[model samples]
Target: MANTREIKNRIESVQQTRKITNAMYLIASTKLRKARNDLANTRPYFDALRGEIKRVFRTAGDVDSPYFYPPDNNTPLEGTYGCLVITADKGLAGVYNQNVIKEAEKLLAQHPDTKLYVVGEYGRRYFDQHRIPIEHSFLYTAQNPTLDRAREISALLLDGFLTGTLKEIFVVYTDMESSLLSEAKSTRLLPFHRMQFTPPAKEKAVQEPFEFYPSVGAVLNSMIPSYVSGFLYSALLDSFCSEQNARMTAMDAANQNAEELLSALRLQYNRVRQAAITQEITEISAGAAAQRRTFGSEG
Candidate 1:
């Protein structure tokens, strides 16, 4: 049975909270739409690049390239594995950061000697707090994902792989399957095999013979880096979209809960106010009747 003032304050607080959550929801929605549009805008270029790579593989038979790691290449790689973990910069996005961090932990457990490359401040802090060593942290890229950032990341990874400092590279990110569903998953980036780019049997078309300017190997060497950059860019976009969607959902739920709380608080405030008014009226009526009785007796 709190006083009306206390209830009114609570109601105002809930209303303020509701306004913040609603604003967050709208912001997240806008971000999500922009991310989707950006992805859509860049998709055709990547699709063409992928198609070209597939064509090269199909037309150029038995090419020797540094990017292609065949199954039977017995040359053991000398370095440890590298993993790039993608996470959101800030949290509030209901379990989005947690799920990706859990996925990264699983990977680290499996590859104990992995070199960790983190993308977000949240992931960097989490790993640091847990005493897990981070090889590198790409600052300010998680929130503002751009082609330049993706290219920079891919360049570094390619350099490590080329220099034999990292044997294999993998990325852990969240994929937005739909507006309501997102899954944290890992994708291997380096030492790509030809089978991965090969078109399916059903989708295969007749390949026309084409000649490369320098050689097939040289052409592949040039194309592989762009392909890798494109792949990384797509992964970043997916993770961003997933984060936005998760935030939107979380904010929506918060807004609803705030509304419910405000409703209850307002009801309680009305009840308390009515009771106070009734009590005051009762006291006034009783006092007046008593004074009238005194006057009547005096008269």
Candidate 2:
């Protein structure tokens, strides 16, 4: 049992911690909403971009480009693979960063010759501490994901792929399925497969032909980079939203735990206080009775 003063101090400490956690919860909520809105605002353009790519594939008829290809079953897997890993700059977001790092590790284990391009400080530090080499780290982009930042990242990756520096590129990030559910996922970014652009069976309909400016390949070359940028932007938004949601959930749980601890501490404080009061009263009564006996003897 702690003394009353110690218990009081403990209660105050917990109260302060609760305040911090509550504030963090509110901040995370705001961030989550903003990220979702950004996603909504940008989704239509990307959706249209994707639709246009599909249309080009449908109308262009077996276009020969470096970007579009089917995987060769006979080709041996050689050359450095590029992995773009997204993680939070700071943690307290439950297992959000852990899940993403784990996913990246899984990718690395399968493809040992990977060149890591990390997006967050957390991921960069983790890989550095583990002695794993990172080819690049995009600092300050995880927390502030913008269109320009996405474009910059995509441009670097596209350059690497086009220059034959990287054979394949993949992005590891978290996808927010709902407010309560988020899952880490890895998606291949390069060597766009024709089947990936194909619409679903239900959505397939008659297509209209589109005339290219100079040639179909030339037009596709221009469009593919922007389309890849859009894809990267969407992934960043998703990962940010998931990180914020995870933080909100973690803070909410901390707040609840703090409340429970405060409740128990208050109850214990009251019990200790009552016991001290009772002991004081007993001591005073005994002293008063002794004084009365002394006076009677004197009389």
Candidate 3:
């Protein structure tokens, strides 16, 4: 007994929604491919940096580099540690945003009350909803992501650690092994192993002690910051690509769900309309038989 006008209106509305979801799906797919390729291209650069770090550690002298500090328990844990959680700005993938949000939640659960550094608008909103504190936020657009901007953010995080404002720094980001496989991981940003500085367990003769032009400490001073910045930037890029891939997958699933829903609704609408028509025909036939009997009796 549904109104015909209401059914028509609903169908039109669903059709419009279907169009929008379809368009978004297409857009996400295109962006996903671009991001995936971009991330792949950036890998060699990261590998080169890794090689440079290994090489630098090999030649470093007796002087203790700031980057090579050991995590001492007795160092007196003062001040708070902040976590940087990187997630995508938009949501459409099935459970993509939810899974990341859950990861953030778990991170927060470990720390009684830790501040959040978020890279996406969606993450900020999620923190706000959960009563989590957000210390800093950076939102990026799809068209352009600047390395300088990423470096600036990384510098802030490192400065906080250096100045004792933030006791320790941890970054939670999605690692993109492949388009199909993405994982959220947390890693300490600083205090790399000095012992293992000279690449791991390959029987090459240890080179002679490294000589510094200015000072080894001074060289460490410059390179440590760059190393931190470069590594963070690379991680962010990987997460960025993962975000796009996650979104693309999510949107694809959403588009499919929407299509399935439309199909179901359409079927329901047809069945209801057909039943309504059949009932009308039954009423008409009944009325005609009743009229014929009345007419024959009158005659």
Candidate 1 is scored at a TM of 0.94
TM-score winner between candidates 2 and 3:
2
Any runs in candidate 2 off by more than 4 Å, and if so which?
71-77, 200-208
Q: What does candidate 1's lDDT look like per residue over 1-299, in tens digits? A: 79987888888888888889899899999989999999999989999998888888777647787787874774535569899999999998999999999988897888787999999989999999999999989987587689999999999999988998899899999999999889999888888767877778787665666989889889989998998898899999999999999999999999989988888888888888999999999999999999999999999
Per TM-score, what order, best first? 2, 1, 3
Q: List the residue pairs that clash in candidate 1.
A: none
Model 3, 1-299: lDDT tens digits are 56666777777887788788778767766876776666667667757767766666556535465556553422424458778877767666556556667777786777655668888777888888877778988766423445686688778887887777777677887777876898888776655656545656674644676567687677666777776776777677777777767766766666677788778778878888888899999999999999999999999
TM for every model, in the order presented, reads 0.94, 0.95, 0.81
Task: Please report the candidate that would top lDDT against the real structure.
Answer: 2
Give lDDT tens digits, candidate 2, residues 11-86.
9999999999999999999998999999999999989988888777777556777886643432434789999999
Q: Over the full model, what C-alpha lDDT does candidate 3 score relative to the true structure?
A: 0.71
